[model samples]
Target: MKYTFYLKKTLSFFLFIPFLFFSCKKECKLSPAECHVYENSGSDCTKTKEKNAPVVASLKEIIHPISGSDPTLNMEELSAIGDYIGSAYFVGLGEATHGTREFFQMKDRLFRYLVQNHGFKVMGFEATWGGALYVNQYVLQGIGTAKKTVRKMKFWTWETEEVIALVEWMRAYNLAHPDEEPLQFYGFDMQSVDEEYFWIKDYLSDLDLDLFNSIDTLLKPYVSVADYQTYPSLSETRKNKFKADLVKAKKLFENKESNLVALSSQQEYDLIHQAFVIFIQNEDILDPKFGKGRDFYMARNSEWIRNYVQPRTKVALWAHNGHVTKGDFWAEGAELYEAHAGNYKVIGFSFSKGSFQAYQPKGVGLTTNNVVEEMDCQTVNALMADVGEDNYYIIFDELESTSAAYKYFHKKNPFFMLGSVFYPDSQNTFISLVNLPEHYDILIYFKESHFAKPY
Candidate 1:
């Protein structure tokens, strides 16, 4: 039931994940790794500067205050961020809430700064690898409109004007740098594979119609019934058969790899091969015996990009804070950090308070509400809110070991976190205890959050 629930909730639709069963704030009993808090340690840090005066003062000394999140504005302040990244090969840019307009805009601004100043080449999203290939087509070749390309991503969280602006910016940058190395966009997730199937079918049909017929016949039965309950709910025997058929299809593709690559571009062959990989990922997600979650597979996909697909190329990944944190506990970025070690970095985002868009209970639509959770100084959100500026960025590695900010960040802090959905009035759902310094190497704090405008 745990596996089926996750499959139906994430793969079928509404794929915003890590749907943890949170404990009550009044008597929280969840483990420190899961709830991200130290038991009975809420008073470990000081609420006023009297007991922790050095911490606040240290934060002010090393913090770089930014003017605003507007990407079109002067970016001289953001140029300092590149110095912190140094030679890191992979950088994770995380959002506190998926529906924040300011966060989205700020990422756009930060990404532009990285591309223009640094030698970063690839931009990966927490989206489907197969669908993102189509988006890559539009950005590199002008094959489709920005709105249509983003919609192909199949996530309501990304169907926003803010995202579209970023996509168009990528295209514009590529066009302007015709002679230089153009930036490449990719998706590192494998949950949604509609676009994967389309590309695989198109490739097979064009080259080998008879082989295409056999594979399509096997896949046809499930196409019409691929709904929330119908697909992931398949019986054990049927699921095994489905996986066997996909394995056979992959073998068929592998046998013809040489001929396919000779006839078409290497890019085309790579697309179909990756599609088969995604099909296997889809099957594994449904099989409890696979013993892995989406985060593990997402980490593998991103690593594949850096190690296999584009070796030596630096990548900037965009995803939620939960997926991007590198804490000792569980997270996609944590997996990557373990594999890459000093070559990777995670930058976390945060907000004090304001209205932001979120999904309601059913599949109705998005709602905007102000979250008024009472946050004491023990939390990073409250501490950042007390800063002198409305916006600022901090690098944990830059702090002195004896600085108060270093000690404060090393302790447990209940950071405010939100996915794509939440109850209408449940502000407690947004609270999560996290060790800031361990989870993220850099931090960007916004004084207030604003709802992301949907396209």
Candidate 2:
């Protein structure tokens, strides 16, 4: 949720500026009063007498050791995850750092496992909703090359060789399952509106030229915003007018909903309506006066996908650990989804140390750097390292209540939560503190991480 990378370089950063300036600074230290209570709840972080002994012993028992993160490997080791998923509707797969090779590969691997075993039909990303539709076109219809489509999604974090591999795999899967419904890929985040706006104009133009012109004229003034730095300088009256125009656009969509659905499929009409909603969300989050953050709308956009866009289909969300955790930091929206969806499960990733790609400090551009070797006995990464497995995953809910691992999870621990931007020396600033049991249902840990190979 750090606004330092996406919009900082282009058009996506403005919406999350508030998050970078405000939420990113929040950290739960080893303070006595806040050591381990479940973030919103008052449950105590109980300590065990044996320190790491019992926890390590229990971890050794429950952890599912994997051969590697490679998706092509015999994935029989990942079969246990299906049992942990049970009947969950949404599986939020999170990455410790957006640019880690193994994390991306692991997610690509896990998603393949889920689709094959669990009948998961949809996958959503933390990307611009309208833009990712093209990627979906590549997956479902093979409309373009995977590398070019992935690059067009516009998030530098996702422009990687690992992701290209995933897209290629998805396309292959669809080809193999000729009789079945093909897998669906989409972006749930509503940070930018240019793609949505352009699509809407084209969609409406096909349906009704007058409607398209009216809506386009209403939205034209705001669409030219090329950067985040300029939006804050707009006068209040102008901002209010922009907000009003967005509402008018939505009303126009609503007034002709039945006709629109008649001309297009219900699904197409719904997508058009959602595009307007995203435009409003992009406007609201970027507006300095609005209190709602990008995560707030992101949660809603994700729900919209689950409930309407791809109704009755199991969805796997791909995002950063900060956006997926049910903990309080930048999780206001994820918490909302957990409450409403009820069957949501989050899987968080971690690494002991390595290098990752991130935008250079102050948003100069992309660079890869090794993380400083920082570790603490109380942190989750160190505890997982104590287990001595190069790669393993643990499902917290599967552990017995009396087990040392369960008690260890009950306590708050520092987690490696790097985003798309990094300051190697300022590790403490990005590593967040959270009760693992409350924030994530499953934890995947790798002993070392490497930078994602760029395509």
Best by TM-score: 1
Per-candidate TM vs. native? Answer: 0.86, 0.85
Per-residue lDDT over 295-353 for candidate 2, one digit per residue giving the tens place of the 0 to 100 score: 88777877787765346778888999888887654573365555655578889998876
- Candidate 2: where are CA atoms >4 Å away? 1-51, 329-333, 362-364
How do the residues 1-455 of candidate 1 rate in per-residue lDDT, one tens digit apiece? Answer: 11122122112211223222233364447543333222332464444546666677788998989888888877788766788788888999999888888899998898888888887877889998877876776777776788888888887888888888988998898788877666777888877667777877877877888878987876655444444456667787887788788788888888888888887656556656877887777667656565377788888888777654457878889999999889955688999999988888888998876656777665635655324333545567877877677999998888898887888888786787789876544455667778788889889998877778777
Relative to the true structure, candidate 2 has a C-alpha RMSD (angstroms) of 9.4
Off by over 4 Å in 1: 1-53, 222-228, 289-291, 307-309, 362-364, 373-377
Consecutive 10-residue window with the lowest summed lDDT within model 1: 1-10
